[model samples]
Target: MYRKILITTDGSAVSQHTACAGVKFAQQMGAEVLALFVAPDYQYPVYVEIIPPSYPSEEEYVAQMRRLGEEYMGKIMRSCAGANLQHACMTAFSDTAALKIVDVAEQEGCDLIFMGSHGRSGWGQLLLGSVTNKVLSHTTKPVLVHRLISEPASG
Candidate 1:
């Protein structure tokens, strides 16, 4: 019964897994998908001798992250198209992805949020501070969290 479904991706396996299901769900509901990729904000290192940062300037660094966002968004858009689902892609820079994701979902009037969880627990969860958990805590809209099953390491 969702009109708009927002899916967040970070090019991780878990995120992609979540997206695959999200697309199917959206398709079934005839809902439009909003594929959003949030890039981390770039921070320039303090100059020791003004050797010029590798990116040269803050503008260049931001541009690079934006490019990465676009690339990831394009990949998701292709999958959405394959499912015959109408979708749009968006990119944003934020220090905290969870907060930004929740804010975007509210601002865009999305009915549901589908995202992947890293499936961290106990000390891991406490130390890493899950984005999905934070988003769940903040958002008022429906959120579906998908976690990929961990596979045993190859010998």
Candidate 2:
């Protein structure tokens, strides 16, 4: 029933795997897919009047993040190609990834958001805020969260 699906990735193995699955799902539904990678924006060091020599300039940071985004988007591209699915990919620089994801989905007119979650619980989840959780909290659209399940160890 989904006309378009937005699949997000962070370049992690779990997210990559989830993105591939999302592509296949989109294919099955005859829906177009938009793969998005959100890179963190450059942050200037605080409390220091003078910028540190070791810190990268804004141009350098953007170039580095663009390279990383391409690397991550490449995997999604291959998956879409293999699935024979209609797909497009983009990269955005935003420290608030959840907000960016929601905005992109809305702007692209995507009916579904498919993404991976580490599935942390208890204190861990509390300590490290989850983008998936934030997206869920913020968005009114339907979200399909794929929790990465560890494979059983071979004896």
Candidate 3:
């Protein structure tokens, strides 16, 4: 039984669904939930000398990302409230989301991590590295990955 659960979200529809489910799972286990949103760090242009006019400043980027995190975390908050589960939420700025998630889980003493996997495979997965996969590889803590089921294409 998990005493504390770490639920991670990236604001995607699948992640939102998984977060809600994770909240429900925590409620069932009578565990406290720590909802986390990891926003990508602001990246500098490769050609610093030729910065694009529309490019956001670091401050502007952080502010925007924070707002987005709030929106995403808000859903988890509502779910926790509805479930009457003890919970807290935070947003972290980190490009390495997998590392950040593992670090937060350890730092917070979470017994379990609940997160969503997009289920990409083969070349797609290789080209676009999976955060869930990385978390699985790097962390010794228990991770429950909720994979989104895709509907079969209509002929």
Candidate 4:
């Protein structure tokens, strides 16, 4: 019943797995896919401690993140080529990635969202702070979350 589906990815194994499910679902439903990757804003002062300030300027770091996001999103699209599904990719900056995904879904007029329960970083799940949970709480759209495994929370 969906005409447009939005799938979020981060080039992780779980993301690829999620994309596969999304692709099959989209194919069966006759829907086009919009693959999106929202790079978390990396300009905060906190990042100075995480990364060397001399390596890249704050602006350059954000740009690099966006570029990597696009490349990862593109990889997702390429992987779906065998399915012959119509698709597009987008990249945005947001510290709140779940909210950004929902925003993009609305902007793209997508009927459904498909994404991994956690991206490559795995920090989301590690902290019981899954992006899927945030999106589920914030949006009315249908979401399919792909989980890599069943694990108890670790403090």
Best-fitting candidate, measured by lDDT?
Answer: 3
Off by over 4 Å in 3: 119-129, 151-155
Question: For candidate 4, what is the lDDT?
Answer: 0.77
Task: State every prediction's TM-score relative to the real structure.
Answer: 0.83, 0.85, 0.85, 0.79
Q: Give the TM-score of candidate 1.
A: 0.83
Query: Which clashing pairs does model 4 show?
Result: none
For model 1, which pairs clash?
Answer: none
The clash numbers for all candidates, in the given order, read: 0, 0, 0, 0
Off by over 4 Å in 2: 47-49, 119-129, 151-155
Q: Could you tell me how far off, in angstroms, the CA of residue 131 lies in candidate 3 after the best superposition?
A: 0.9
Which residue pairs collide, candidate 2?
none
- Over 33-89, each residue of candidate 2 has an lDDT whose tens digit, in order, gives 999988888887895588889888899999998888889889888888888888889
Off by over 4 Å in 4: 44-53, 127-129, 148-155
Looking at model 1, report the run of 10 residues with the lowest lDDT sum.
119-128
Per-residue error for 51 in candidate 4, Å, reads: 12
Model 4 C-alpha lDDT per residue in residues 1-155, reported as the tens digit of each score: 89999988766666766777788888899889999877767655665567654676777887788788777776667756767878888888888888898999998999999877765555644422367788999999998776767432322
Alpha-carbon deviation at 57 in model 1, angstroms? 2.1
Q: What is candidate 2's CA lDDT for residue 14?
A: 62
Model 3's TM-score against the true structure: 0.85
- True lDDT of residue 114, candidate 2: 95
